[model samples]
Target chain A: MLTCKDFLSELSDYLDDSVDSEIKAKLEEHIKACPNCWVVCDTTRKTIQVYKGQTECSIPLDIHARLMAAIEKKCAERGK
Target chain B: MSAPGSEAIVSEESGDLALARTGDAQAFANLIQRYEGKIFRLAQHITQNREDAEDVLQETFLKAYTHLDQFQGNSKFYTWIVRIAVNQALMKLRKRKTDRTVSMDEGIDTGEDIVAREIATWDPSPEEQYGREELAEILDSAVQSLAPAYRTVFVLRDIEDLSTEETAAALDLSIPAVKSRLLRARLQLREKLTKFFKHKGDDAFAYM
Candidate 1:
């Protein structure tokens, strides 16, 4: 049986689905019996979910226009 | 996608790519339009400042356009572009003298340093019932608190949804290296958030 510390080391691969099936089962079993480790794993997963859900802010219209205009200027220069 | 053996291939991405490669500025602009917001978000995440992130975003496209011919088509165009943006973000961070430059192995040095601490799990969970704006603020700070090595991996892997191999390739780290850093990053973030979420008003979850 892996200790909580041992589970901590491999928690990422286990969550990532990168762990081999047998080792995954063992880690899952450990967390099931261990609330501390379980919270650690669950909270981490939710944290990632939260981060993934962050809204993507659009580039302001003026900045976008300036970028396009600058690129257009460069293209015009190449044509000259 | 054309029929497997057909000579005529189609995909606006590929079509735009072809034109962009030939110095067609409009085609390149089309490509940038699709990706600029995403790349800017990535830059903003890593540089942790709007000014630096914008600089990275602009420089990434300028560099990509100048070297468009060097892009191999083996990867999706956005994937190729994102790799460039990641580099630019890192360069901007380094220029600020704020990059932590530690690999997972070197960063942890010895795993023994992380002592276990008891933490209360919030009954309502964080994303539930927490005001959306406040949660967003906390999430941003938590991510920003990570060292550069781990934060980049977390952004690329978790937030950007880059595959492990793709994240590894973009960051020039080995597959195992990427995995380790991402794991460490998540653990540290979890630890940070546990403290932030533990103090819900008692009645908020009395029903549970």
Candidate 2:
């Protein structure tokens, strides 16, 4: 059985699935047994989901066209 | 099926980057089309203004084009461009420091007052206000109010979904620095969000 500290410490790694199998199993056991730790997991998952949705910035089409033209202009200047 | 010409363009871009380093304008044009958006977004995130972001984007690519020969293969081309944009943004920030006025520490201190005012102004019954979208908006505002250094790391890791190594490379920060800053930023944001919701919840319960 993993301690709460172990679960908390490894939480990020476990969530990222970068932890070893044995530790992962222990962490899972701890989560199953501990409501407090489970809440941490739930909140972290929700937070990440919300964070992902919030950061999608829309790029304008004109910016792309202008950027291309600028890069071409620079290249032309450099070629001379 | 992939467009037959697309592969050629990618290959040509790679070759063009190589040729552009040796002074090839056409090749550099291809490289620009390939990377402009990524560069633009990186600049926009750092500067937080479209006009300044465009300036940084233009400056970064021009600088990158000039210094392309110095790009070692140690990092990806995208990473190199990101570095240039970040540096350019930082330089601009330093130049515009007078406009910022408040230091981050002072900002945080005063921001507490702002938070309090916001809380006070909210309709007394928050339980009646169950807007998940509103909660997200509050969260975004809180994030925006974070110091640029903290905000940058948070956005790179949490928002932009960059891996640790990629973020480290892009920011020229050590992995440990990236990890420390990321955790601290997340903790600060969480604390603010928790307080916001908890206060609302308490108010809602009190009215019941």
Candidate 3:
């Protein structure tokens, strides 16, 4: 029987789908039988999902202008 | 100006990349326009500051442009730029000399600390319950609470969608080290988020 500690150790690999079949099956069996582990697994998965869903912050206009000016200066220097 | 989320630039990236390598300023600017938003976001997440992120964004592209010939094309241009951005961000972090920075080599034990303290299941679609800006604030605060070592790994591996091998290479960590840090980061963030997302009637302080 996989203990909660054991399941915790493998949780990341399990979520990543990188665990071998035997360990994966054991993890699945453990989660099915253990609500706590299941919640941990499910919530952890959702945590990743939430972060991944975040849209990239757009560069502020002032910063964008500064970046362009810097690039233009550098290009001119290289040209010279 | 290109729209903020213009992924259409991807198909044209290779052509711009070729021209940019040959010192075409407009082509390089196009490349910057496509990736600046994402690179700025990446810098913000790692450095946890807007000023540092802006500097990193500028420095990363400037360095990339200067070293354009050194880019061997073994990786996607985005990935190559990401490496530069990450390094620039880390340099900023180090310069601040804050206590939050921990050596990535410090060994983390996956023992009792790994146990899930908040076992309550979350509301389905908990993120949907909050406004997008609120959710972003919550997520950012949660990530910022983590130590820099874990935060960097999580940002690169999870948020940036870098492959484990690529992340390991970028951070100069062995594969197992990356896996361990990522695991710790995920569980820690999960536990932190549970405080916000768990069921209403459930014991918010519930322990397994």
> Judged by DockQ, which candidate is best?
3
DockQ of 3: 0.83
Residue-level lDDT tens digits of model 1 in A1-80: 99988888888887777889998999999999998888778777776777777766689787677667767776787679
Clashing pairs in 2: none
**lDDT, model 2:** 0.65
Q: Score the docking of each candidate (DockQ).
A: 0.61, 0.30, 0.83
Best by lDDT, which number? Answer: 3
What is the clash tally of candidate 1? 0
Which regions in candidate 2 have their CA more than 4 angstroms from the true location?
A1-9, A54-58, B1-13, B98-140, B190-208
For residues B40-131, what per-residue lDDT tens digits would candidate 3 score against the true structure? 98899989999989899999999999999998888778888888998888888778865545556543554557778888878999878899
- Model 1 docking category: medium
lDDT of 2 by residue, B80-152 (tens): 7877887787677667866472222222232122111112122233333557678656766777667777777
Better of 2 and 3 by DockQ: 3
1 against 3, candidate with superior lDDT? 3
Tell me the deviation in Å of residue A12 in model 1.
1.4
Which ranking of candidates, highest TM-score first? 3, 1, 2
